[model samples]
Target: MAQGEPEAEILLNTIESQTLAVIDRLNRAILMLVTGQPTVSGYSAMVGTLRPSFDQIAQYAPRWGDLIPDAPHIRAELAYLLSQRGPLDRLQTPHLWAALGLDQESVRQIYQSRYGDLPSSERTRPTAAAAPKTEPPSLPWIDASLFQSLQNELQPIYLPSGKALFRQGDPGDSLYLISNGRVKVVVGEGETAKTVAEFGQNALVGEMSLLSGGNRSASVYAIRDSELFRLPKASFERLVEHHPRLMLEVAKVISTRLENATSGKPRADQALSLAVIPAGDGADLGAFCDQLVESLRTHFDCAHLSRAHLDSALGEGIVDAPLGTLRESRLISWLAVQSELYPCLVYSADPTLTEWTKRCIRQADRVLVVGEGRGTPDLNPIERALFEGDSFHPEIRKELVLLHQGGQAPQHTQRWLAHRQVADYHHLDPHNRAHFDRYARFLVGRPLGLVLSGGSVRGFAHIGVLRALREAGIPVDIIGGTSAGSLIGAQAAMGWDDVRMEQENKALFKNVRRLIDLTLPVTSFAAGKGFSSLLKQIFGDHLIEDLWIKYFCVSADLTAAQLRIHRTGLIRRYVRASSAIPAALPPVLDDGHLLVDGGLMNNLPVLPMVEIIKSGTVIAVDVSNPFYTADGAYNYGDPENGDSLPFGKVLRGRVLSRTLVTPSLVGILLRCLEIGTINMESVQIPKVDLYIRPPVDDIGSGDVSSMDKLIQLGYETAHQQLKGWKGRPPA
Candidate 1:
């Protein structure tokens, strides 16, 4: 017997005990079915609810397959019942029993044996449900030998009851697998501590931090005297080398806990990684590429490699080396030649690769197409190169947009880019090494606070911004939004893709135009419910709590004369309330006060984001296009009188009307120039690292077709903003 055999036996026994408890529940349910007056519908519902629990218990104890007779047939019966619709009485009971391979008499006898007796009157009827057929082996069974082998690789540590294994925010470098007793997972500290879950023997803990290589998100404390197998990162890595399945298991556990923690849907990162920056003809593409390489080298432990360098380094080792460091130099040279062996390799867009850029594009997870401000490079050759690749790279579907440098968008550039089905960026400065460095840090691994500024129909540009970020592989961990931005931010929090969002936005605007009952007059609040209904139809039953990322919507409370950041409520309602421009829609009522759009008072919404995300450096994306060169290009607001405003004359509804409505075009332009420019001085927040104000002017037409230009601008701006940001592979 192995050294850990006894402990493994104990673990198996505990799991068996839990399985038996589940069986007991099943037996009791059967007893009620035999004697109790349960309608066929009610009985079917009971079975439906209980079936999953049986499967869950079975997963924990695979041996249940042997112990539980007729389990397979029972599972089949349950499945069949679940698949059927409408009245249950329409089916033949005997045919169901035969198909389920169940004997009613046997079930009643077993139920009667366990619960003393069944009602005499009920026994005369068809004997309820029977025991399930023997289940087939399903769960991945960890035998004594496997357990002992794993134990030999890890150090066993014992802790007294009430002792902590690890605390929230503590640096973690080890995985803890419980050998005995239990542990409680807690979040927060001191009086604010809250228990999230408790796990017993054989359960894994601390894997989240171990996999992420970050501080613990929560704390684990021993609920009782416990024994744990502590596997150091080194040992776990070795184990994964030999048993790859173990890694998948660990990922599953971590994913489950994360889903529960954030109330987000289960999601995995995309495999295809490529960012294409079109450095125009005038732009120095090589210098820009070198800067990106340097920033990545400074931040991540990575080095650049070209085909020539790789061949030369492999064939002829470095000749110039210090006496003592000859071996170190040779090793680095060898590794450079063998870059494919490393877990991560970030390369530059070598001009040489341009000859095979199309083939390279197929192989790469991400590709950055650098072009001039005028338009994209001749894509015909690149597209032709893609056809030469034997096998398509999994991430080939990743972004392939044109990144422009300097100047306003060229007239022909839009047509050219749209023809290639690619987006364009004109806001990035290739010379800004400092911004690239920060962007590199963001790309490698940095939490971001995404602040979305309200811009009504103009907000469609934000989709391009999100697409660029997604392509670059930068994830926004926290979000704040105002008015139309709140709608975009909510979608981000829900993990909606950029393409889907763009399509939905186009559909929404079309619906808005058609649904507005102009016959009823604009001042009568006729469009409010229809608009709200549209939002509901699109968002469905999603709540603010359903947001995968921490998020808040900004709105102004008219009665309180205050800006409010709402964190929890119906997501559609929150968006509607935040977008309630005085005369445009009805004011949303909350806590006896009416609230309208936050843009009038807080158009930028930086403070609300700063308030929620206190610790990390905040990177904000300010989308509000408050500046316009010409009066015709400017978007203006109307008068906000109670009679004219659809939100009503309650509390301080007219507060913004009195304070914010500036009639002078010169004054509005000046204020826009003052507030619209994004800089540290303007924001006044010490923690803010980067605040981006994309080049977008107001569009008064609100034309749906005009959105393509805004989206293109957004794409170009976001792509430029993420100049040094790069995507990372799944951990």
Candidate 2:
């Protein structure tokens, strides 16, 4: 019954007729329409049909709904189809938002707000034009009604190529949504634009930084002529309550872009939202807390009620505002106050509330389990079921993984699950026991991957371990189980879903994932919380496309260039299909040696990481990993004569392995054998995805200087052993 639904269904049918590659292009074209800058763009007849375009997109990504913008010709067609003609024309003017109806007077006043109080003459840095008109919404969460309201409220502006829209770290004053032209986002501490993401009409920007009052995560500049709408914070918040669905939809689009541009690692803005919020008990807490109690209330009921009921309920003495508006505002204000007082964070979940809890475990100094394995009326209906039991095995039970589970791990877990199979390795093979201890050694130099799961909170001892890890530069990714603070590492890594972080936070997560996938080596992770069920519910048949593998860049450890160098050796060969490993890249090293391997993974030219063993004096060497095959398939390179194949050279029959290698230990061993500085010198580590930061469990005896507690823990001894590794290549 909404304004666009009937028309939307018709559009979807048309998109279904397109070829697969065309679908992706169509998706981009539609996005360009919504995000394009209006004021400076020259509209073409070919670009004006909203209806036909919507119908085309509807054909393919139907459930994607009308939030998906229409391509030029299709948008024009849709305008005529909806009997809403003038608005869909490709124009750089006020007609776009004006056709829907938003506040003009409030808008213009905001334009000259003098963000830096520049002189009136100095303020002329290419002003934004009048925006489309939009009035206040008549109903909450209804897309069409909100659209109508926003139609009455904006001043449009067009940006030309090379135009500086805003700078990174700039103060936030207003939010802009593209209407006509394309703009590119440049990130990385204002150094240079490394990864460029383009946004056209309907794409939103500036909201996340504005709302959080944080410095801009990435700078924005125009590429082509652009039409835009400026939405200040107050108006944005007002629109959020009245039209929650619209706000959420806008966010999803932005998030998708950032994720695509940076691989999986989000921009700095997103990184914060995903990180764990600290947890600590207030010493002066408890007793009568009125303000703290008020926030948990909601006004969803008030918004849906009839005017008559509201009039009777509040009477004439109340302020003359919309009944729904007043009630929602009251609830929001109360909730905000409570959040401030409690100093606790909360988040809404999709299938189950796990992301929030995951964060709590990561940051909490201590946790107290206060439940009795069940819930009563005292807790919310959903709360009891989520928190009343253990859903996962403990983070560390010493050694009881396979025993508790019904069956042995399939072939997948073989190499990954080898050690720690017994409570004590005393009776195990000497080599295997040493292998277990190698984990500790690997952890000493590199950061560790600390994951958390389940419902109940762990004791302070666990928190202490996490702190130690953090101090050692370990990057923890907590996968939250249902209940309490469920926001965990992956969510933090990806940011929240389309509906969660609004637009800004979503963009942050998307960027994080982009960088993560592109930079790190990706290995498959076992699904948790029945991810298959969640994937099916949301993405339908194409779960592989929807469930993405993202890469995250750790800022503290490495520079972007170093990371790019490492990633260049990887990415190009990825087979993009669901079965994993691209067809273009065959296996290069099933033999498992780092130094000599048969076959290159991809034919692309790359600098492979050469291995260095302690041979007294062997200069650092660089090897190439170009998936070349001279005989093409049969690689009989023979490193002795340097006869190689186009695919790769098979130097040896098998690699000698000490087994159980950690990333950090390898880094140190490689460095020491190459005669690189082993002493402490400030060095930054470049980031890559899927590689877990090793935890510091022991210290080497040779480490000198002001040894910290970790160093005293004997983590360094093993670290030295790993650095001075005198083993043959893995065999």
Candidate 3:
């Protein structure tokens, strides 16, 4: 050991002790001042009263040079106080404000407002640049005693002076904290070797690589016979689970080293790579690639590359890249460079999975597998590699994404892919491309879409159900709606997050009477000003054409007798038309045409959504049920023998008009919406069809019992359906 080692150790130990004492005093003093919540009138008086504690902090502050490595402003503030004379009041100097991390112009304004004198500042020096920001949930530095106790939990090892701890380029499997003696960090071979840094007691080594999941950047050797607490990767991860603050401290240490290594400017690459693959037969690879490329290009505004590959047998027709039997390593290297440049690189898999295709899958950070509805693909060699052989990389499943051709996945497929993500497929439409924009932000393996069906007040129950799904982290990427569903769907599509939607739902239901015209019978005209007012309150008076989600609002043109799916327009227009109950409220006039409720034609707009989405799964939350029969089928209201039919079914066509005359005008008008349609039977796409049957005979009542029942059903259904998927440990 060096002659000065004991003195150096004693000095460090004293500094650590004093530093902890200062921190304790500072925290108490700050809390004491903040508790009273002093106003500006007594602010200066409070500062004067806390002068003694402040002096103590200033007295011990110099010893914290190493303890507070990142806070230059704090150090500068302390230095100015150490040189001060009288009480700290009426001294509005620019340097003093700068030392407290305030800008010169802001300080100048404060000085002009208070002290009334702008003092000549000839001796002021520039303040140091603020510390680089760290990702949040920051923690205070641990005291030496607490740090030592943490080390006691790990196994200790001793090494001779000449022993090497680790070599550059080796896998970083552990980190070492010096208990005694010192270690030297070195880089390069013997001829070019240079010392990078040195560490002594309590200093950590090899933490950077361990935290980053990278190789060691330098070699470490004990300069003297040393005792070290060896924290293996497993032990470190276990500690992280309990003490997440340890990650921040480790980041601080690494940031210091990195700042020095790069002369205070380290450029870290923040980009990620993704690969898309097909998981079933007859899947459209070209459409999937185009969707992925367009989504990435539009969202990130960066180049999105897709390499269209073909088997050697079909090489004659291949246009993108003709693989002329080159070396596999060289090809991989070229692809790796392309990946570094582009945020997303989609590789179109050949009909036959080859060794080269598997290599591409292996290189990706994430892989999305596209498949049609209800079908699971046979395990190819690449997929088989995920489970078999000595390399049992279970993480391969985490990378796997099952994007359904339609919105729904079969029960068997869902069970088989319990660990993987299931996402919804989306089409490229100019008006609905906002769905891709919102989806690209998450960059998730499993993307989701929401489908809402109309059923007047019953749709409120659907909203509660959607809230539960969102709380469970089941992503909802886009929304498609019909009638009352359009009202709820527009709120979601217009960027109303869970908290906002829940609040609005409660507020709207509380004043349900204001939205219902009591003077009129229960007909289409019964919708009052309160519904329009609530819509305006929820989504302001603006056309949300550039919203983050792609939405479909279905409304039928009575004049044209054509079903219209409006994507881009004033949201109010769609909501008004979709909510236009025939014979009850006036038909909504849009683009000089009269449009009625879309539910009259297609109550469950799932088939329309399924037709457009080229890839991915969909979540169809149906609130509409043309009343269910005893046999669990739709009750298509018949008017035979003076039976009063549901209002919507009556408007289907002239074929039913001959027998659809009302038996009791007022009674039928009030109970018209009670009859259910055959919309569910018409649905051909496989999806999550949630049929919400309110416990009451009347579906449109906004009573508490009905709303509560719907909310409970939604909560129970969400928790049950997402049982196998939610809150599992990461793969």
Candidate 4:
């Protein structure tokens, strides 16, 4: 060997041995933090051990920067840990544990196991003191004292299973309050009888009869052994006199039940009959049916009876006669029997088979028109005639389901929709089993709502997110937004694809001067005319109600001091109102109300989407300012020569430096607005099925120069986060 080769090898081995020892210490420290009891002394020892190991690891960060790129992040986490006041403080801080690569939920559970739930002061953080110290308003129906009073005037009765509480047409003398078990409310009798509603604990039953002073509307029977408190008619009248709100609450329930019965929509507990019909030739109708049936079987007792299945049944004498030979009444009876046999019945129909298709359509609660997304969107003459003819029921919900292969974006969907009266549309990948499962959940009436948060220029990131979602085949059935989100969401609702949106955003933001209309700063810095003109150029007098997708935007109403959701109005006007930043742009006057930027209140607007869908998959994209620690905000300084910090820290430092060095009135107002919005997002984001926070913390809300970068960041973030997003069904 060459001279000094043996000595060099000995030196390298010595260094490797020292490094492995440091790693071993670091692993033990992390394990102790994760698995050890969260005692102050134990955690303190862990922190003490972790500090020197982290410092030792950080010394090698520069040499392995490219190989172990998360070095800077680890350093920041270590910095955060060392900055904590005490072990108790560190244990209480969930974010610290999360930053240190510990499971946040497990940390919370461990902390709570020792300390119970976090107090209100800890839960609200900085805003805890701002919360009003008053008892929350209570409703009469939920008041414990009111319930106790009512119970004092009534006697409890035990109900045995299969026993009738009261028969239909019985005189309305009393109302029963169910304290335990379950009961079914039925109408008619024997084979004609139907259980229209069911009640369990805390439910008020037979209130309709008592309130109307008439015979019972339905027979109440105990399906399970139960206990009920009986309030006589005289007592109920006296109670209503003392508590007027109770009558109103009961009336509200009755009104809701009456409306539901008259609406012709099935109850939540009822079975669903769906018919899948191919719209055009070459559509994989059989395969789609099989996949759908398989997907539905995951969450439902599903039965698939295609034309072939029916033929087999008829040949086996399971069906008495051929469907063609059966009378209309008999066919209806058979369809009803199938619906009763399964929680979900899927009828796969061939468009060419006019009689068979008609039968399926007639029996269906909903009809799914399946088409190849890339193929011609035209419907066959037979299909069109069957759908439009007198035989087709107008009440049957018709929705378009476009199947794609190889991750193709939906094309010519509007054309396909025009062929028939479709309530909504969906894009599906035939080869993706997960896609089929998602579609099945949608069929069960759990839709997907996409919420885009507002961050002015940062909103451009939403375009990239939309691009990634389309590419990943994530469906967005309803969309809601605020401020900048409204501008982007309007385009999306207007059917602007990701590419088109990207092109439009680039063209619009290329020259920022076009968006400015400088005026005297009495009300705002700009007159808002420029922004209005820009919106007009894109929307051209279209109504919000006329958007291709179901959409809404939120705006802060200054007159009412409340948030307004604009689902119907002139599109440009409402969007302009929603985007009007207070002190920067003038408030918009619409429908006799002055509206300002919705970011002043709800920047994410997820709650409105939740209210609209009632039950659905909600995916929220937050492009708001990135969160920073107090230490990161104040202690951040320039790194030494040849030393590099994490990209996040660098971005945060830049933003903080600019704000702290030379703060302006507009900047202060905007910062406050951002803080409030961030707090609100924390609450709303958890309610959604998926929450996407793009890596654009360094990009300021007003920074329009790096629109391309922001978009790319959003695209990458969404693609990474949605890798395992198989949306949940409605609760």
Off by over 4 Å in 4: 1-271, 274-333, 340-342, 345-442, 626-660, 724-731
lDDT of 3: 0.51
Measured by TM-score, how close is model 3 to the native structure? Answer: 0.37
Q: What TM-score number comes out for model 4? A: 0.47
Lowest summed lDDT window (length 10), candidate 2: 270-279
Better of 2 and 4 by lDDT: 4
TM-score result, candidate 1: 0.35
RMSD of each: 26.4, 25.5, 25.1, 29.7
Candidate 3's C-alpha runs over 4 A off are: 1-446, 518-524, 625-680, 685-705, 725-731
- For residues 125-213, could you state the per-residue lDDT of candidate 2 as single tens digits? 32443322221122333454454445334444656555768888787767776543446777864355553454543466775653476
Error of 3 at 422 (Å): 27
* Tens-digit lDDT string for candidate 4 (1-731): 43323433332222223333323323222221122211123222222122233323233322222221122333233323333322212234333333333344543444344445533324444321121111112332435445444534565577866589999999989877654445788999999998776655445678666677799878988755555667788876787788777676656665665675554332332335677888766477889888988988877678887768866643343233445332222333344335434568888876575567766665565778888878887777646764676555443467878888886644455566677777666677799876677667667656678899888788999998999988987666678998878999999988799999988878877778877888998998899888888889898877765554668999889899898998866889988988888988899987788899898888899888876665577889888655444435543344565544566765786877754323334545555556766777666766777899898878866788888998999999999888876763332
| C-alpha lDDT of all candidate models, in order | 0.52, 0.28, 0.51, 0.65
Compose the digit string of candidate 3's lDDT tens values, residues 1-731: 43323433443333334433333322322212222111123222221122233333333434333332123333333323333431222232333333333344544454444444343434343344222111111124434433333433455566656578999998888876554445778898689988766555445677665677678889987755555666677766776677676666556656765664554221121233454565544266566566656766643334333344433422333223334321222243234334323435556554445544454454444455555434564654544554343332233323333344333312233333443333332322322344444445445322355677766666766667677776776556667888768887888766677567667787667856677664455445565466667777766654534334557788878888888787756678678787777776678887788887787766657666654442334566656533323422324444565655666656763465554333344224323432333434444334433333333345443354376666666566656666664322111
> What is the alpha-carbon RMSD of candidate 4 to the true structure?
29.7
In Å, residue 464's CA in model 1 sits off its true spot by 0.4
Highest-TM-score candidate: 4
For model 2 the TM-score comes to 0.24
